[model samples]
Target: MAVIATLADVRDTDPVDLTPLQSTVDPEELDSLVRVRNGANGDTHVTFTHEGHAITVHSYGMVAITPEHELTAEKYERGEGR
Candidate 1:
């Protein structure tokens, strides 16, 4: 089977717990986002800023979180986010 890694997994952060982001984003909305994008077509994602961090959650079961400013620089350097 295929293995999907999340933002926490990539960043080596805490486990997959959206409790902290609950205050910033509605849990139900987040759940809906994930549910709707679970298995669709092309790259589908939602971006939001939470606690000064830019967060992008993808459809295939992964989230990318990075500092607002640094995110641009990093993505540029890596030729990502094109």
Candidate 2:
């Protein structure tokens, strides 16, 4: 997954690059994880922590990211993270 794409959807500002996620999981791995979760659960979602933010990627092509401080965990878990 492209963190920049997901971040762009959830955040107000546009990120020029994913440099901030350099220490996080590889983008390819993230993409692979989403693919696996989608395949295993048939369009389900999988979430993980990245840079202190909770990131959820759904098989329906929705990516929701909320920081811990925002306390949007319930919304994200309900697939309403947007």
- As for candidate 1, its clashing pairs are none
lDDT of each: 0.61, 0.66
> By TM-score, how accurate is candidate 1?
0.54
| 1-82: candidate 1 lDDT, tens digit per residue | 0011344454455544433666677756776666544344656777887655677776676677776879778888998977
Best by lDDT: 2
In model 1, where do residues sit more than 4 Å from their true spots? Answer: 1-19, 36-40, 72-82
Clashing pairs in 2: 1-31
Best by TM-score: 2
Model 2: per-residue lDDT, tens digit, 1-82? 3566677656655665444664665666667656644344677666777655788877667778888666677778778887
